[model samples]
Target: MSWHSDDGSGTTADRTVEVWPDDDRLAEELGDALRDAELAERVAAAGRAALAAHRREAAERDDLALELFLLTLVHDSELAGGPVGVRDRSGSTSRTLVFEGDGVGVEVELQDGQVEGQLVPAQAGRVTVRRPDGDVAVVDTDEVGWFHLDARPHGPVRLVCESTRGTCVTEWLSW
Candidate 1:
């Protein structure tokens, strides 16, 4: 038994294959192969089911994200359009970004190779630093809603705040 098939580069390739010989073991081997194929199909179905469930969960999270406060960029001190923080002692061209909102306000200070922030209407919470690559860090706020990220923002970054009051996701900003 022999055959010819494409080698997957738009080129045809010669192939050689052998079929089972006619013998008492042939039937048993065929039955085993069939059973193995069935098992493979079952496993594939399970994988599909798991993928669907994961997608559904992601959709649910997106829906809930709608209720979250999307922190908008209201002020950027470097542009001289807003106020900058006075606590920047290391002064590595420190910049302040204020995201003002009706319910919760946020101020982010970038200085001395650190990212510091404070939430308005101070409350305890968790802030997740998210970057285009992936999650950078998740830092918990103090009782006064002050938090700092250990990871430095290299590129565009966003913050997801989950506090006692509510959840909010910030707009992506280039750091």
Candidate 2:
């Protein structure tokens, strides 16, 4: 016998099958095929939904359109004015960056694989630390706008702060 089946593209294709009236196995095989087809359609629908969700997130990230500014790096000794000359050291030295905007200011200190930072005009908010490879670590700031992250992110990194002043995204930096 010949029948038509949907190929999932709003089009039908002819399928030829042989039916044996006395063979009970044919009936079982047909039932199994129908079940498998239904399962495949469900799986495809799920995959489509996941893809749509991912696209929406990407769009939101792009829509924020936060400005990126360079942060000036300063060493502890420089701030203290102990010595003006450069010195060669074996180990790493502590570094600090101060980012000042119109109404927002952020201070970050990096030492010993730990990040300690404070935000000016202190308000409660969440801070997100993002790596270049899309890895993110988040922390909530206290009422005083203090936050800490015990992670060492290699390569370029950036920060995103969501506070009463709205969202602020920092320029990529390297430690």
Per-model TM-score on C-alpha atoms: 0.64, 0.53
User: Please, what are the lDDT tens digits per residue for candidate 2 over residues 51-158?
Assistant: 999999988777655543333333333466655433437455666667666678678877778888887778888888888778568999999889999986888988
- How many clashes does each candidate structure show, in the order listed? 0, 0
- Candidate 2 collision pairs: none
Worst 10-residue lDDT window, candidate 1: 81-90
Alpha-carbon lDDT, every model: 0.81, 0.74
The prediction achieving the highest TM-score against the true structure is 1
What does candidate 1's lDDT look like per residue over 1-175, in tens digits? 8778987899987778767677767888867876797787997899999999999999999989676877787878877745544554554467788886558878888877688999887888888889888898999999989998767777888988887767887788887
Worst 10 residues of 2 by lDDT: 68-77
Q: How much lDDT does candidate 2 score? A: 0.74
